[model samples]
Target: MKRRKFIGLLGGAAASWPLAARAQQTRMPAIGFLRSSSSAPSQFLATALREGLKEQGFVEGQNVQIEYRYAEDEKERLRNLATDLLARPLAVIVADTIAAIQIKAAATTVPLIFASGGDPVAAGLVTSLNRPGGNVTGVVFFATLLGAKRLELLRRAVPNAAMIGVLTSRTSPNVEAERGDIEAAALALGQQLTVVDVNGEDEFDTAFVTFIRSGARALLIGSGTLLTTNRARIIALAARHALPAVYPHREGALDGGMMSYGASVADAYRQAGIYAGRILKGEKAADLPVMRSSKFEFVLNLRTTKALGIDIPPTLLALTDEVIE
Candidate 1:
């Protein structure tokens, strides 16, 4: 009878062992994603990020979960929403710009991966780029002031323009700093930069009026995603006023703006996705140094140039990575 009891006990223990193993395997890691713009996910980056995660064995509904929060209309709410997600066991949090600001303050221990359009060190997100030193490290969209290069490209597209207009958001947090960069670049190029601040549809009229009044023959627009989203209206306004315009990113050019010169947004976001997957595979955020955009896209829309009565330089057309006719 003692031998029979011993065998029975062994069977029970074996069954219980699998239970403990299953318990350990069942606890899914979670990630929190904060999007400041409604169009963020619709872009190719979001999809690329998900694809990266899948490659790293992080099947969204299977091994890991992500809590998504979007402050679509009111970007001001990103921080508060991120704070709410802080109550959970988040393995990593992905944010950008103002959304990153809130995530940094909400968790002291959780890892953060950010892809912002500003200086990470200047923004107080990390100690340095090579060694982020803490729970933060990602990529920067504004690698440098490519503003003047953009202006030069616009001039090439519209060779007859003797004056160029600059449109920017007077209310952007980095407005003044960006203005200085653009001014310095324009000065170095011996090109005059006329500044026009637009904040709303009505303000656009006065802003364009001021641009023309300043004798700006072409428009070089600034600001970050805020300006990119309003590209349709800006493009229309530029066309209506018969002024050639240069935008910061290819998206705007694709949206009908005359030309764009800047880092490839699609590739940066793809890298973000790759980073996210690496983190899931036991790579620490601190170990992964931030990367600058090595690839810059020069996009020119032949259709837009024709509509503006401008002739795109053969040199500029030859340098373009993609020309939309």
Candidate 2:
């Protein structure tokens, strides 16, 4: 009887071993991924980040866990969402530019990594890019700085468009600076520009109307989370209005916009993921220098050009990095 009892006890212990191992796996380090835009539109960016993490040997679900939260273009919800993320037992927090600002404002002590489109110093996220000097560091793609380049590309595509319309977001932190850049570029190119600001999606129709009434012949979509989140709608509107438009990211061209000139947003997110992995591997966020995105893409859509009946200048076509049919 005693031998039978010992055998049963050993069997019971063996049966519980797998559950113990699973419980330990469940306790693996988790990363908090916060974005200020909608998830569906930015899924590719998330995948890019995961790819970066994988490069650092931190595959999600197998070794590390990633908790993703998106505010869906609602800026007001960012802080609360960030706070909720903070409530989790996370190893690191990775956020987009706007979401980083809100999370920093909440005074989080977690290791924070940001994928920013604007200047990190100007946004008060870091003291300097080289040495962040705090629990914050990530990537800066400088998308806002490419406004003039986008304007130039649009002008090249629509050489006869004298009155160019600009659609800018009023709520973006870098709005005024981007507007100033576009205006200065337009002035230098000897082009008349009509600038219209939209605060929400409801105002898009009105803004388009204002642009048309102002005799604007082309459109320059400004850089911001708001504009990027609603890119499809804006592209549809541009097509409906028969406006030759230039966008700030390649995703815009891929989605049927006329053209786009900007740094790779996916690469920036991937770099941010690398930073997160580094931090997870015992590197300090403050010690990691901010990475500047070096990959820029000039994408043009032939379908959009045909729809708008614009002839692509051969010189511009030669300079394009990617052409969509």
- Among these predictions, the greatest TM-score belongs to 2
Query: Where is model 1 poorest over a 10-residue stretch in terms of lDDT?
Result: 36-45
The Cα local distance difference test for each model comes to 0.75, 0.89
Best candidate according to lDDT: 2
- Candidate 2 structure lDDT: 0.89
CA deviation > 4 Å runs, candidate 2: 1-26
Clashes of each: 1, 0
- Give residue 8's lDDT in candidate 1 (0 to 100): 98
lDDT per residue as tens, model 2, 108-142: 57999998888889999999999998899989888
lDDT of 1: 0.75
Q: How far out, in Å, is residue 33 in model 2?
A: 1.0
Q: Candidate 1: lDDT of 269?
A: 63
When summed lDDT is taken over every stretch of 10 residues in candidate 2, the lowest stretch is 100-109
TM agreement with the true structure for every prediction: 0.84, 0.92
Model 2: residue 172 alpha-carbon error in angstroms? 1.8
